[model samples]
Target: MKLISGGRRVAGNDESTTPRTTGTKEGTPSFALPRGVTLLFAIAGGTAVANVYFAQPLLVTLGRDFAISPATLGAVVTLTQLGYGLGLFFIVPLGDLVDRRRLIVMQLLLLAAALTVVGTATIAALLLAGMAAVGLLAVVTQTLVAFAASLAPPAQRGRVVGLVTSGVVTGILLARTVSGLLADLAGWRSVYLTSVALTCALALALHHVLPPRDTAAPSMNYGQLLRSTLTLFAQERLLRLRALLALLIFAAFSTLWSCVALPLSAPPLSLSHTAIGAFGLVGAAGALAATAAGRLNDRGLSQRTTGIGLALLVASWLPLTFARQSLWALAVGVIVLDLAVQAVHVTNQSLIYTLRPDAGSRLIGGYMVFYSLGSALGAIASTALYAVAGWGAVCALGAAISCLALLLWAGTRRRTPASAAAD
Candidate 1:
């Protein structure tokens, strides 16, 4: 029950919040995981993130049958964001308290049930409610991230988070692709069914591969977790900066996806749903940026990595202006955009996870609250702008958000110390 030097915490001590008595080898590869572990990560990340976008590609079809206005149909997305934000505040913090694998399994089961309801809901209100439930359980991604951090060696923390986060990035990118294909082949309902299948499979896979819990960190009730999350938000300036950065970036991100399909699937191009999904494949290049950042983070270049990622964010917006000219330009933009977001996100997490290792789950929850808010605002604004002003407005809005995010980063860069920056 002692605090380590240089602000590092050993677990089980009141003064220091890092989990202790976890019996970890400082430099060992606890990441010597089985195939089941990888499968669980892919499935868990895919299913959780997919909940955010399942309805995006399917909204038009839902509108055709349900007779809801586009604004209301948009609630299918908005309600989900609200629910996800709530879950990030309430559920994600539990990872540091309870056993992560068990929590993940339980949430996966709940998500499966929610997806089932979404697949079968016939009314707009019912569908919205189902989407909310789906999002509530979708915070399972936070648990997976915490679990990965807990298993990683300190030296490789960045790489481990980056690797797992790469899975999450893939999920975010592929959700649209998967939904497009499923919506085209079967029905919009089939998208939910696909998530259900993945959720069930991952629940089983994680049960086998995840390690046992560490007894050092004390488990708390939900109320205690909430207090911890709030305390983190109140105490950590870096958390504020990172959260603000996330909001701006995600706003740009949601705005792009919200409006991109409108142009691609309309007027000049008239792309099919499957074709739009194929476009998502271009974002897979982001995995490289994420991996490179991980290596750089270990090499004490987190600040440089974050700065580069932010620069890429600003640079990525230029190609969208050329959508009227070429598809390749849009593809490159998507890759750069995803790469930038993932790199900054992983670097931010590597810095924050060590801030309060005992509260990893709650810290993530607090950060994601702002993330969800940005997403909702972006999606709403993007669609509304596209409604009146066309693709130019949507693309311009996205670029503006990215520019603002960069501004925020620049404003904060000089003030932070070398350790947090390198971390």
Candidate 2:
């Protein structure tokens, strides 16, 4: 249960005993990560992730432009997601094997090109290809995350990660809203074109501000680096537990988000699309509030944060069950659910980063693969369950998933030493 690094537990006390470096060969950072630099990383990560979600609101418009059927248009998002999943395993590991600053800049430039392709595509297949490319490069967000963790002092890694991750959550929650607004003002193509410009600007900014890795790269081939990423699950018990937690928590998170609109649109409420989209803003507020979880993790309270967040996640369903009866109830549930999910999510990343600072990229990339799977599972299951049963069944399913995560954490805690679990 202990991650023994140099004959002691690699928890809470790492900053005091271990060198303040992520890589054994990599020299220390040139300077402390400035708040402005941290904000840049956050905004960059958020913008990169937003590309994946932009198509969600533009599918109908895209279909009209390409003269494609509704069912066929879903492939735009699906292909993009599939590309993202592939990049986690194949592309993200490169962060450990190369110069991360250069890698991030390269990916950003490529993402801009991909956006351009999407903006100018005249054929359905071409658009799908462009979207896939966008997804592939969007994983620059993960690379930025790993890079940020590497640059931070060991003591402050959790806090920096929390802030950057909050940006990612904000981008996710707001992409559809922004996309819809832009599409309305200009056109569907303008959505991608605007991202192209933003992405190019971010690339230039990051290229200037990102610190160079002063250490030697990992001495492994590309294939070995990837194999090691897979073997990490076998080698590190904490990684395994945290990955499973990611899967469960995000399933619960996505369960609420993927289908909440159905009930809102069909019910006696009959809320407009804009009204349903406004809920994302409420969720973003909750996510932003949970940024404190990272600070608590810096205090070696990750285990405590996860426990409370999961409990709140389960309880949030109570208000959500009354969503049909009250808009106030729905909004409250959305806030609580998003807050709980982000709190635990930040805790998971904070703890996992401690396991392998040198392999931060591989660790986070592997962890997020589970996150993506859980989201897909929840999105599919929630819509199907809502169709067959009702919103109540969907809530039941979400509560069950949250309860399962709680039970898993409880079991893990009982077996793990407090020092190690808290680490």
Candidate 3:
């Protein structure tokens, strides 16, 4: 499959990432998306993405229920992330090849079924299988993002993407809090059951509300479609740089989230699940604050947004370094980290979508591959590091990753062709 550039197919050797300069002709329409549609997209994307994270706060409960050892409990999250990573490569690319609306609805329905398996599981094997299934179907979140990007006019794509991604970040950050509350009120199983009901409702609503659009059938087979996703990175320098930044940022993000409960639950504080979960609310506030990042990209200030956001990411660790002693400090660190991460994330998506409007799904799906990998790396590395050293070591690792991202952004911003930024 040929990559689309400026509404035309570019050969494999072409290095041009920017679409041709048609000025207002290529970047026209400037339509106002209904507030209701954008809200629905946000809610749907948030709910779908939340499925992968609901397990984080419930790992302790799950370990006891399944009689699993504390040392191996991390496998629960590992399996889910693995499934999600595989889905990003295999299932997300299908958005470009098929009816995205139907595809999204189908994934939701399957996701509901997967949640049912999880909520009803009586054995360890069943629970792991269900979690894996849930993760696989959760790629619907990315599909919703690509669909929203494709629906919006070029001028408004960044704003729409920002709004939808804010929903995604909200889901990811708040899932722990909500799951903690649900687990405290009922049990861990209730968390999955509740999500099952929510997923089904979202599927029906999306099917009804999502407007039917004519999508041309791709000429290439499914294998070629998957290959095209990778081909994009080789072709687009912007995608490559942005994806690497995604890896570093999310690694920093996962570092904080994956092991935070440990220090909170240990002897010094011994906070309850609900108390630790409340930290999510602090992170959610930061995520919402970053919704404006899309507008900044729309204003052609992506470089500034990225530089500032990455610096904030690095600075966030300073407060986190004091988390072992102070709750207030932990809250401040979480907010800064989440805000900076979301801002850079929104900027990354907005910038990449401009490179290939015709291949929206492929671009986002490809970009998110790095996101999954980074999350997995951070999750594993943080836990191991925390065990060997302590919370201080974990914070140091996160700071190092954040600093690497900032340096990479600085180096690339200087070398990126001016024409690419104008797009």
Better of 1 and 2 by TM-score: 1
Clashing residue pair totals per candidate (backbone < 3 A): 3, 1, 0
lDDT of 1 by residue, 102-150 (tens): 8988998888999999989988788889989888889898788877776
Which candidate's lDDT is highest? Answer: 3
lDDT of 2 by residue, 335-366 (tens): 89988999999988988877878899999999
- Candidate 1 segments exceeding 4 Å error: 1-39, 216-220
TM-score per model over all chains: 0.90, 0.86, 0.91
What are the per-residue Cα lDDT tens digits for candidate 3 across 1-423? Answer: 122323332333443422232233355322245556677889999999889988877776788889977656667876787788888889998888998888999999999999999999999999999988888889999999998887677777788899999899899988999988898899888889999999999999888766554545789999999989989999999999999999899999989998898788788898877888888999997556557899888888888888889999999999999998999999999999999999999999988987877778899988998898888888878877877789999999999999999999888887775744653
Question: Against the unseen true structure, what C-alpha lDDT does each candidate score?
Answer: 0.77, 0.81, 0.84
Instruction: Tell me the lDDT of model 3 at 396.
Output: 94
- Candidate 2, residue 423: Cα displacement in angstroms equals 8.6
Instruction: Indicate whether candidate 2 or candidate 3 has the larger TM-score.
Output: 3
Worst 10 residues of 1 by lDDT: 1-10
lDDT score, residue 12, model 3?
Answer: 39
**Could you tell me the TM-score of candidate 1?**
0.90
